[model samples]
Target: MENITFNHIYTLGNIVFENEIYKHYHYPEMLVRYDSNFLAFKKMPSIDEFKAAFTYLRNYHMKHGQSHVKFTFPENQKPPEGFLEYLNDNDFLYGYNELYEIQPDQFPRLKDNPDININPVTAENLDAFLTLQYTFDEEYGEEFAKQKVALHNRNFKDEQIMQVLAYYRGLPAGSVDIIISEDTAEIDQLSVLDTMQRKGIGGRLQKFVMDHFPQKTIILVADGNDTPREMYQKQNYQYVGFKYECIKVFE
Candidate 1:
């Protein structure tokens, strides 16, 4: 099989990343998806241009009714000369400090992270997961929870929304999902509630997931959670890349 280079994927007709890499073109374009972390990209547009890109991308995904987003930078080189200023002017948020990626191969054992009793959850545990999602949201997602509730009510004989669930101290603590792609698995909706902060419940569950699927590469987006991000780093996963906050504004 031919290796799908990032450039080749652009032949699908997307050229935002490579186009921005060129110094000559000031074309500010972006690629975004909100189902994951919110992220944005663009050439060196003006401060307003950056803001527009930032807002536009976020707005697009918001219309999709996504809850959150994360922006990431892809580079092996040192930080750009004016990267911070550019980000600040554009409302692009980052961590309290520099961010890093984490892997489970390095931190393989869940026994060390925390005592999360992990398992593959099914219809039996759907309601519990929704309850957890209800508490995880900043401003309670009633509508989102309605959507989640509808998900729980699904009775698909042939096809259904796939999910994974984990229990911490015999209660639901975290989860990652099985997505649409056959080969690539998207880690969706991993949450460790505020009441359970600093317990390492999320870590142990993630370890169990990684250990379960050794052949697969895990991809998840971390928000402002330092513990989760730190846990990922201690495990040795480097930041492969990030997506943009995708939004489409009304003309």
Candidate 2:
């Protein structure tokens, strides 16, 4: 992947995540919630700035009864010297995530499921979109599901975003969010119901997004340790690079 293009995708994703959190929480500034309550920064601080940043976040969360601290860096970037060791010394658990990308032209031909129809979400179908998302995410527990649905609802108000829902024989079966930038189209929070897996609903939705923004580059991130990255590779997405993530949970 082109390095500039890759960075653009990463920056766009950070903006998308931060915006979603702000809208969901009704906060004025860019902030994110992880593990239910702790707030996180959109961009990683440099090594020299890490301590002050960490202290502030820690104090705010601890004061608010939040018990976790998390930090994520963009691909090919490293945290400040001893950042991981500091977290380790402080009992912070850490991990990493894989970032993936695909050109619309490179996406494989999806098996057209005649029964499935993917459409942009509008006010008329907003409820269906939220319900489908809640169903797919409910396993994460009620609070997470509720927040996710709320995030999507808030994202709908953003002109740069296009929320999609796939219907199988008149029932919502899958959903995804597309964040459109001038040069790229970033796909986020793609989900299909458990019962609808392996039925081509996801691929159909993917194709729908490509068709919707035929000229822009498409990008997404997947868990490095999970099966989804492999699946994305099979669908013609490339494993461009990955970022390291570290988190600490307070006792």
Best by TM-score: 2
Model 1, position 183: C-alpha lDDT score: 36
lDDT of 1 by residue, 156-196 (tens): 12132345667767877766554323333345556666677
Query: What C-alpha lDDT do the candidate models reach, one value each?
Result: 0.46, 0.70
In angstroms, the error of model 1 at 226 is 3.3
RMSD of each: 7.8, 5.3
Model 2, span 1-251: residue lDDT tens: 34433345423222213432121111222223463333334466655555665675577656656655666555566666577677678777676677777788888876656799999999999998888888877786677688677677778998988999999888998998888888788888898888888888888988988888888778887777788888898998877777777777666
> Best-fitting candidate, measured by lDDT?
2
Clash tally, candidates in order: 19, 0
Off by over 4 Å in 2: 1-32, 35-53, 77-90
Q: What lDDT score is found at residue 209 in candidate 2? A: 82
- The lDDT of model 2 is 0.70
